[model samples]
Target: MNSSVPYLLAILGEGVVPPSTMVCHGDDLGLLRGDGVFDATRIVTTEDGTSRIDHLEEHLSRFARSIAGIDGPTPDMDSWHRLIEDAARNWRVPGEATLKLVYTNGREVVPGPPRGFLIIAPLSETHMEEREGINVLCLSRGVTSDAFADAPWLLGGVKTLSYAVNVAALRYAKSQGADDVIFTSTEGYLLEGPTSGLVVKANDALWTTPTGTTGILSSITVNTVFEAADDNGVKTATRLMRRDEVLRAQGAWLLSSIRGVVPILSIDGHPAPHDDEMTHRLRVWAGFEE
Candidate 1:
């Protein structure tokens, strides 16, 4: 382990410990069945050691909702706040990092209480690289835009840890020499990226896929971007968009919490139109500079 690498890991009741140490049991349902929920936010540290966590309250609220969606008890927000603060204080690295809150249903057989933890680690350079630009592969999510309308069991808006499929999609995209993936619905509507929200610029307005009926997770970053755009006198809307429309858009981006905003350079090997000026404006609006 590199001693120079700073990290903080805190179990709900256990305080902080070395990140490399073993924490969970083999029978934990989060491990055995991929039953868990998580939320991540960018944590920025100044040269003076002061740190600020982006959208902390919003992420916590969403995290609690995700837990409930997975049949887990609503977590105590106060306790989570304390744990996060403790970990943040211990993480002395002076740069950008990610703070991830994770929760899982307890052991599968001898279940008692859900397990919760916080990991504060440095942000990935790859994420930073992608912010400049990326090529995406359009893949089928095998569901229609309205699939989540009445399907509570599908856990549409939930940010569950069951991300095997999402990860696989990204892996497949990489296998095809692409940097990311934009999942399209079976009905052929542009949905979202595996770990980010799809945002398009067309007709001088910002557009994104609808959340409630499209089974896409509500993206805090996208909402923040839209709010900033609104303040800057830009129009925003939510609508069902097709691949052809996205391909012909004035600009496209994949927006997420940690990565902020990343422009799409191409889709399925075809050059997608982009506006550098708009992308720069989005970065400014998203506070990506800080």
Candidate 2:
């Protein structure tokens, strides 16, 4: 948007526009009511001025599912593909950045098609630092693990624009002198982080919470790590776990798109075991070895 904003490239539709260009208006549902869906992935730029987007197809598929969760029209995948390519082609800063896709339900004041756009920007230093390790607090989500069952309206597993609660959770954790939070169901089952997925090492296998009824947003990064682990003879599972179990587990980590894999150092002031080998392996599996 301004000169002070470091390395930003935006594409609203098939054309690239200035970072400060207005992509949405006041009446836009995404702004006024948070009726939108989005997804993001890592974009690594090499010294050769070439950028590579990881889990590109998986991000698109999940984004489509999010749009469907909101009963929105299907996005133009081809246009988005072209726009992403254009954005990546122009983003040759030779560093790690994020590629985000945003789609909203149309404007209410003046009818218009849904606003879809792509953004490429440099990653934050904080995110990079967290990749080293983190101390998280377990917070209650006020919903049972099965609260979303048979209730599509709950939008379980949907990546929506309404993230105020997530922001609040993170703020609360910061106030508590913690780096992040792991949301648990009212029944006390570990769900996920505000913006990341929880991956616990237990019984010599990699396990994460379930999605369907757990109201947990499925994590592409976790899936990528699990896939890599599978290839390397590690077992993986999807199941519900509690904070006590996480504290007693062999290891734990928060995996996400932008941040990659971040090992958990402690939870709620309770120390958890740290496995350097496991952390390094998870990072490499998640493609965030750097």
Candidate 3:
């Protein structure tokens, strides 16, 4: 392992390794093939060293969904939380930090026992801030056929370890001089972002796609936003939204745990309004009152 990569901390089951340890053969296989699903959850640490797992239970539930979707082994919530807390303790990250829990199928193509792997790494600084707004580029649905419909759609909702298509989509968006991409269905309905939720202000209400209603992994950020918005007398709803409605929205965002709530500056070449009242209201409601 290269010392320059800056390894903060790592936990392998009951064992802990420093920055110079090499992974097991099975771990290499799973990671090499991208045969795993993972979730990102942020932890808030106090100056005195006290730590609270933000939305821990919700993240664990999402982990269960990913495990079940890939027919992989499931870990007990109590035990998994313990592992996460242990890793976080070792990290000693100041303030708030994002923790990523990964579960892999252990490199077996055929059906076999799957104990998988778990990892906790420091999140990049880019995701920790409240972005001014995002510029999104529209992409094709047929290419990522997994995200086509509500349920049984092309594994769009599932957080599968396979992300070849996701990388390609983001790269293509970057080539067009955009910050991110908003994927839609063949029928022209808004779906989600590469790593975030579809959050838009429209019809004088806070709206997001009903991926949760369709058996998809309901985004914790989306739920948190709704809670905050509703508390502030803002109407929030989860429903099927058309592409035209999204482009014509008053204020738009890609809400996620790490990215917080990101506003959209442009969509498919058209510039959007910046710093609207709705944007400020939604951000405050989401606890990002910054």
Off by over 4 Å in 3: 1-6, 24-29, 46-50, 109-118, 128-130, 143-156, 212-216
At residue 109, give the lDDT of candidate 3: 44
RMSD of 2: 1.2
Q: Count the backbone clashes (under 3 Å) in each candidate.
A: 0, 0, 4
Q: Give the lowest summed-lDDT range of ten residues in model 2.
A: 5-14
Query: Least accurate stretch of 10 residues (summed lDDT) in model 3?
Result: 141-150
**Model 1, residue pairs in steric clash:** none
The lDDT per prediction is 0.91, 0.90, 0.68
Number of the top candidate by lDDT? 1
Scored against the true structure, residue 81 in model 1 reaches a CA lDDT of 93
Cα error, candidate 1, residue 163 (Å)? 0.3
Error of 2 at 73 (Å): 1.0
Model 2 has a clash total of: 0
Candidates 1 and 3, the one with greater TM-score: 1
Across residues 152-230, which tens digit of lDDT does each residue of candidate 2 receive?
Answer: 9999999999999999999999998899999989888989999999999999999999989878999999999989999
